[model samples]
Target: MDIEIIAIGGYEEAGRNMTAVRCGRDIVIFDMGLRLDQTTLNEDADIVGMQVADLVKIKAIPDDSVLKANDGTVKAIVCSHGHIDHIGAIPMLAQRYNAPIIATPYTTELIRQQMAGDTKAGDAAKLMALKAGQRYTLSQNLILEFVRTQHSIIDAVTPVLHTPEGAIVYALDFKLDRTPVIGEPPDVARLRQIGKEGVLALIVECTNVGKKGRCPSERIARDLVRDTITTYEDDKNAIIVSTFSSHVSRIKTIAECAHEIGRKPVLLGRSMEKYATIAEQMKLVSFPETTSAFGNRRTIDRTLRRIMKGGKDQFLPIVTGHQGEPGSVLTRIATGDTPYQLMQGDKVIFSANIIPTPLNFGQRHLIEARMQLVGARVFEDLHVSGHAYREDHYEFIQFLQPEHVIPAHGGMTMTAEYILFAGEMGYTPHATAHLMKNGQRVKIR
Candidate 1:
């Protein structure tokens, strides 16, 4: 059997991550995602109703038209997690393929919600739930297994395709944290066992390869949040935190800390409510009893009014817009567009790093200026990264000593850095380790 790895979108940039693995006539598609920076350019962009061709033209979603020339039938569309950059394009792209969308139970629910309004995608694709440590047989020649893994979001896994040639491991977005806040640590024992079994090709993420040392564990982040929030336990000032809404573990930590400080946790904004509500409904996570969430704009405004009326110091608002996106809860509050007023000595804690885009940097600067103008004290970077650093990637390579290495989920600089790191392990560039771009392919066998 001939095996080839195709880089669809994420290789050239950090988002819109889609990759296809073709084994003879059978092809398995992985992660139909979106580019947030591109998609968010127009604040009022109607993405749900936008055509795939239009999104492709604007470089928002993966241009899967490259697949038409590749001779193979798509067997399955596998999603790694529920992050918008990982599963965001499902509504626009999954309908084109006659295959079931396979993801963890939480991710499946998110996908179902994502495809709810799109008649074409909703009617065309079937959603399937596969838990971590479970195996699904795609065909006689292909066996799909979801190896347990830890990431920012809960229920993350590294999908492995067991083929006749060897096991093709897809480790796009994951970490090797021994002590995760929400789930078990990455299944190191199983990954080592797979390494012994023979891995043909390993497609891995290179987002943080340029950074040295292992990435800090989420436990450390939990402690940081606890230390920061507990300091103001007796203070009379309002405290608000902005972070990634999909990061349930982080949100749980924030909510618990708020409860510990004797303040009610109020989750604001649409994404915050959606991710947390789904996780709670699935019994994956539970927030404090004093926690409440409001999603719709009207409800969110009403909740903000209630918070203001009750007293700002009585509640800790965990909201969206850590990147200072336009119209986000934090942005609205900073710009005085929301009912929630920012008074002097009010605390605004950003629990997320800027996503490293020119637009994000400018927007974050603008929001910080606005908050400062209101005399709100700003605390930044009270969080850790979800991507694996250099040492983590080294340890990962040690776990899966595959024949070929394909660095993904980043641009040329990131992938090039990974190639250099792989060289330190005796892997030659393009010979053992490969650097790829959008719409490119490499044959391992």
Candidate 2:
């Protein structure tokens, strides 16, 4: 049996995560995502109307030139989760191959929403919703199984491809959160069963391999939010919280805390509305009756006016722009571009971290400075990462025990850390632990 693995993206950086695994003539692609920073940088370039060639030129999407060589071999495009960095490029790239885009219900819904807004690519896209723990046979030689895994987003899965050679596990973008706020824990039993069945090779994410110990659970974040909010007892000041819009669990926790503190919760901004609507439609989480949500600018303006009139102190505004995007609601409110104003001692809780990019760091700094200038108190980093840290990586390696390992979903330094960690775990480089580069291919037999 011959298996060739190619890294189309997500090897050199954190975004645009696409990989192609070929077993003989049949190929399967995992994750068609975008480089969010690059996409944001080129937002003014009219990406929607630009040709595929021009989008590739600007690095907004993955360069699928290699796949063009083996055009009809693609059997499926599997998305691991609903994060933009993991599924955003589907509208731009999935139609290139005449294969169904398979993902969980939430992920499929997100892709459909993304496609609906893109006139250039939405008309031709095909989607198939596959729930976690279900199996789908793509061909006589290949079978796909999705193992439910915990992450920041809802319905995350780790796909295992059962081939004639053995089982190949794609374990990207997951964390072992035993105490998750919403979904079930990672399916450790299924992983152990696959390990016993003898995994041929395992491709895993290394986003937080450099950090020591297991990442904190989402429950801890909930407690932090509760404690922080309760500290302002009867303060009667505007309280705003910012986080990743895709983090439905965090949003639920924030809403719960807002209600507990005698304040109504309101979700604002386009992405916040999009993700929350998807979650609510799927019944993953439900907001309280007092909760209000808005997507469009005009509606947001009207809602803010109502919120201010009813007393901003009685409402908690949960918004997008955790990374401080220029046009996001948080930034607009901070820059005095909105009808609502920040008063002295008003609290802005950032329940997210800076993405460690220069653009994000600069934007966040500027927004914080502006908020401080307006005499608003800012609190940051009241959250934990959704990726597995070093100890969790060790636990995952022990659980899977694949013959070969490939580190993915991070930059050079992060992947190198995984390589060293694998070495320490007794896996030899090049022989067992494969260090791959973007667009490079490796053959395993």
Candidate 3:
């Protein structure tokens, strides 16, 4: 048996996740993602005209020179979710491969939207939608299986590649949330069945491995939102909440809570509208009929002016910029770029965590300081992570019991922590636990 795994990216850094697996002559690539820190900072003057060489210089997307060397050997490009860190680079890098890009319905929709935004990418991408749990044969020796998984985004999946060597599971950016607000729980039964059959290697994420316990469920976050909104319902000032736009479940919870408190739920931002519209079209989550989404600058300004004319307390606006992006709706609102003003005692809920990068820290500090100068009450860290924590990793390892494990989706320190945690589960380094770096290759015989 000959199976080789290549870490294209996402091993040395926290983002830009891409991995290539080769079993004999067939090669399959999983997750062409982006590094948000680089992509967000470098404002692409023309994404459509930007060449792959330019993107490589900025390191916004993975350097897929290794995969490109194989050319027509690639059978498929499979994506596990719709998160930018996992699917963002598809628009820029997917055209390099001759294989069809396969993903779940919602993820496929997002890729289509990204391609549509860029004319060059529009003609380059060839996407095929496959529902979770369905098996698609990529070649005579390879079958692709998607296991429905719980994550921050809608329609996230765990891809299991059934090769002649054995079964290889790619479990990245997921949590075992039993009580999710919208999607079904993690498909543990399918995972266990795969383990029973046999698993050659398990490439899992180590994003939250430093954390000790299981990550809290989305239900807890919904309850927190409910309590906070209830306590501030009688306030006369406007209420604004910001979170990850791709978090359809969290967005749905916030919308429902706002509706229950007798306030109109308004989504204001380009990304917020993009994801919400796709989820609605896919019938994943249903917002109230009264909920309104504003996508462009003109529409957002007009809607904010209307809200300002009426009592601000009558509307609950959910915008983007949880990471304090420069041009996002939250930053514009804080900087007085919008028509509406954040007055004294107005509520601003950050339903997300600071991503802990230097750029993010500085940007968030600026935004918070600006909001404080205007005397707005800020509530932060009211969100739960979508990645599995250390305990969840241990449980998943026990369930899979694979012959070998490769930790992905983190930096060296985070990946080290996962290695230590896996040691506690009786996996020895270099024997069963393989710690890989970007551009490194490992062979399983």
Candidate 4:
């Protein structure tokens, strides 16, 4: 059987993910996602309806034309995780293909939420809740396995699509966290078995493969939070923290710290409320009873009044805008777009790294410059990545030993560095590495 992979939007950059795998005439879709920055401007319909492109140049919402070209050959659609960069394009793409999407339970919830929240209703989705070890048959030719993985969000998995020829493992955006609180460890046993079974091709995420060492654990991140917050966190002032809203584990850690320090935690912003509700319903995370969630302007106004009057130290607010998105809750609070006024000497903790994009770089710096002017103390980089570093990736290659390898999730420089890790192993230059860009296709036998 001949296999062809189209490197869709996310291949060239960090977001707007789309990928296609063709075997003979049968095709399997890996993910369909959107660029967060681009999607921020798009309304609900713009987000979930149509094959959105050409108008939103910054976004590439999967290569739907390629999927259609399969002519009903799509056997299944598998989303690796819940990050918008991985599943954001699903509602748009799933409408065109009548395929059952396979993902873990938490990821399933996210997909459903995204669909339900979208004006399109994402009703086109046909979802299958997959556990880490469950095996499902996509077609006679493709038997698929879901191998659990660790990431910022829970229920991340590396999919192993088993074909008659061999297995192709799609390992994207995973960190090998032995101590992940939400799920079992990475299915290392299955990975070892796949290694023994002989993997045909392994598509690995190159998001952080350029970094040489293994990523620090979430526990380290907790310690960083402890150090940053205790040292700079104003127990005497209202504390504001910002982070990736989808990151439930990180949120749990911060919540724990807030409780330990006797700050009443308040979750702000839309995403913060959404994921936390899902996580609580799923029992993946739980916050202390003292924590409160606020969304509406009027509610937040009342809460801030109580906080301002009672004492700045009375409540700790967790809001979005880690990348300095202009109108996000934290940004509005910082700039006074919202009713909440910041007292001088108040502290803002950024439990995130400024995603290194030109747009994000400028926006975040501008926000920080403004914060500095307002005399707000800011603590940043007190976070850990959810992706494996180069050394961790080396271990992944050593484990899978696939006949072909493709770096699927980074720019040219990062992608090349990702593929080079495989080259360092025994595989030849041509036999091993394929660093593909968006719109490019790689054929495998």
TM-score of each: 0.98, 0.97, 0.97, 0.93
Return the candidate ranking by lDDT, descending: 1, 3, 2, 4
lDDT of 4 by residue, 1-445 (tens): 8877767767777777778788888888898777766555421123544434552454556555544563348888899998887887776667667678888888899888777766654563488888888999888788889988898887788988998778999988799888775667788878988998999898888888878789888778888887766665435866889988888888887887788888888888777877887888888788888888776667766777787788778778888789888767777787777657776687888998888877888878887877778788888898999999888888887788788888877777878777677777765555567878787788887
Error at 207, model 2, angstroms: 0.8
lDDT for position 443 in model 1: 91
Backbone clashes in model 1: 0
**Local error of candidate 1 at residue 18 (angstroms):** 0.6
Candidate 3 residue lDDT tens string, 257-312: 88988889999888888899889987888998889999888999999999999889
Q: Which candidate tops TM-score?
A: 1
Q: Of the candidates numbered 1 and 4, which has the greater lDDT value?
A: 1
Better of 1 and 2 by lDDT: 1
How good is model 2 by TM-score?
0.97
Q: Over the stretch 1-445, how does candidate 1's per-residue lDDT look in tens digits? A: 9999989989988889999999999999999988889777422123677778888998889989889745689999999988877888899998888899999999999889878856657563489999999999998799999999999999999999999999999997998899999989999999999999999999999999999999999999999988889986469889999999999999999999999888999999888998899999999999999999988789989999998999998999999889999988899899989899998999999999998889999999999999999799999999999999999999998998999999999889999999999999899998989999899989998
Collision pairs in model 1: none
Instruction: State each model's CA lDDT, in order.
Output: 0.90, 0.87, 0.87, 0.78
Compose the digit string of candidate 2's lDDT tens values, residues 391-427.
9999998888898899998889988889999999999
**Higher-TM-score candidate among 1 and 4?**
1
- Select the stronger candidate by lDDT from 2 and 4: 2
